[model samples]
Target: MSAAVPPVRKERNNMRARAALMSPALLIIGGFLVAPLFVVLVYSFLTPGTYGGVIWEWTTDAYVQFLFEKDIFDETLIFSTAYLQIYSRSFVQAAASTAICFLIGFPTAYFIATRPAAQRNMWVLLVTVPYWINLLIRTIAMLFLVRDNGPLNHLLLSWGIIDEPIHIAYTNFGVGIGLVYSYLPFMVLPIYATIERFDFRLVEAAFDLYADRWTVLWKIILPLCAPGVIAGSLLVFIPSLGAFIAPDLLGGGKNLMIGNLIAMQFQASRNWPFGAAAAMILMTIVLVTLIFYARRQGRSTVRLH
Candidate 1:
């Protein structure tokens, strides 16, 4: 029928218009993200070339190398635990940094969220000011401040806190401090966003019901801020796990994380396959974490509803 034909034709035109609008974004994702990930996945299965390239030959040696190293002369697989130790260390540092960020960021975000709207923007700008400078520059600045004979040590020495300059710059302590400083804004902004939308009347109600400050915060404020906290933790944890610059500069290259390992594989070791495998493993872990987090959040939402 002619009437049906017009409606069907209009529907096709609408579909075509939508497809046209989405095509650029779809192409970019496919070309950049999906293609590179596919390349890495394929590289993980291939053999490493003798001279710093892939051989295109299928092999499981990369994954095997993660846990064991082949004996140079015996041609036997020797169980090695060094990489495992590195991974464990990476996890510990990431977790500790996340905890520190949360401890510091929660109060800072709360303070910001409690400020009047006119003043809030300035406070947020201060939080984000460090981001304007290059990360490497900011990290180097930290090194300057914390290094032995640096300003912090000089100040401590002037104040007679200790007889000699303390070695805080090139240690795990320095790395932790750098990580917390670098990622603090990420932790603060998310929690601040969540708290800004929170209803203050609920706080007043809790207080009116004879709830103390601690009780209101523990029960009402934190629970309402849960989404932001989770988001910020993920943002901080994932990157901190793969942190390279802070550890390299602050940890003095003595402390190596998974990111450093990956970089070493590609650059120093000239082992593309192993690097690809490590990258894949890292991606898989992050993916699993995100999925678990998303499911937990969904369940919590359902319960809240």
Candidate 2:
């Protein structure tokens, strides 16, 4: 018979086995995620080359240039608000999209969650049906729908809603609509998952105690499903903040978000260091937001317990 291994040896062997199993994932994260981020961080601190790429010399010009513009004649740094406006626009758009998604998605998720178990799947399937189509195709379809001579305008005209077609396509309004359409599913799914697991007994008890619909919703339902709501908000808000497609196509190059600004720096402007700096700043903001949300969530959970 084989001899039994010592406890210490067995523990070491188990750790080795675990590490062996994790090696592939570790390598993938290191190679793909971490390495790329490191490269971008390094590039952010470098000087932009005359042509396109970054120079070997390290400098903070890229970061400084974000808030200040250098004059061509005297080369004095002048405070600029153009980039700040773009960032503000992106944040406003993202926040608006998240709020709209929550308003629409909450009811939709509640409807789906309250449905018979057999029917719930069909509702979810319908919700996700749009995703099967390519995003570009869907965006283009939205553009066509919102165009001056499109079916939406035709329908509104027929209903005598307006004297003329409303201009939606190639505008910020169209971009907002596109963002809500794109990320609504993200909000719905998380909320549905949370509400599906909720106990109806508590709701019945609240009703029995003479609690009103709004009271039950605010006190019980919303508090219980806050996790999913927060998750969906993050899912929608983060992507919407960095959204390229909606602003690019719907806004028609007229209204530029932060994503478009970063792309312009890299592609049209040929300012690699500036683009890298923008990306790093965006990443930092997202990280800080995530940390803030995480801590708040932890505190809520502690209070609940």
Candidate 3:
């Protein structure tokens, strides 16, 4: 009689079939994601021509230009005084926006997450409904509201609080407000997803064992919800750092971001290679942040598990 086939043999056969079926996804990711990244890396090393195309000379001038070309910015002060200011300001603004969103979204998500399933869905809907409107429209609407003759100024004037309307339409504060408003929902949903399933019983137990609110939060709640915090920070911070449209429209180009500088390289300056380099540099910064966030979160999850 023929020897009976082993269960392990059959399982291996089935596993092979499953792997074969997943080939399409592997191919798709390779083509779309991997290829584009590979191409961009290649482009970053090429030399930019005067006519906007890249020359395959493998030069680092694009990078050197941005890093060392002080005289280009000396006239208006980008090199001497404002060289580092743009990035510093962007960092501060992005940090503030991330912090604000976290503060607001954490409690909001905590409250929503503890609700009944049906009620929780409704609360989420309320927060997400603003996203149905276009971002540009929202920015423009804010611009309209904060304009000198708009409702806010008119109201202030009617109240006799000031003789003239304050110029607020195109300022850093305006840009920050827009960034926070636009990205708030992004931050909220990620946090809500993780925190919604959060077991507050741990906190209650801590309190029962004589832990105070601060202690409970620091030891129990925060550690439990750190994944959500990391996710929210990545969501808000990455986009806020690269925010161009909001700052351009609301801040009126006065609050130009690194994103705007990258755009100008491509469009205004016709410097493809330099643009690619800037893109790569900005991407590197984002990747570093993401790596940090991921490592922190992975360790937290591992410790929790």
| lDDT (CA) per prediction | 0.92, 0.94, 0.83
Residue-level lDDT of model 1, residues 68-112, one tens digit each, is: 988878879999988888888888999999999999999999999
Residue 112, candidate 3: Cα error in Å is 1.5
Regions of candidate 1 where Cα sits further than 4 Å from its true position: 1-7
Best to worst by TM-score, what's the order?
A: 2, 1, 3
lDDT of 1: 0.92
Model 3 sits at a Cα RMSD from the real structure of 3.5
lDDT of 3: 0.83
lDDT of 3 at 39: 84
lDDT of 3 by residue, 244-283 (tens): 8878887888767877777877787888877778778778
Between candidates 1 and 3, the lDDT winner? 1
TM-score of structure candidate 2: 0.96
Highest lDDT against the true fold, candidate: 2
Each model's TM-score, in the order given? 0.94, 0.96, 0.86
Clashing pairs in 1: none
- State candidate 3's TM-score: 0.86
Give the higher-lDDT candidate: 2 or 3: 2
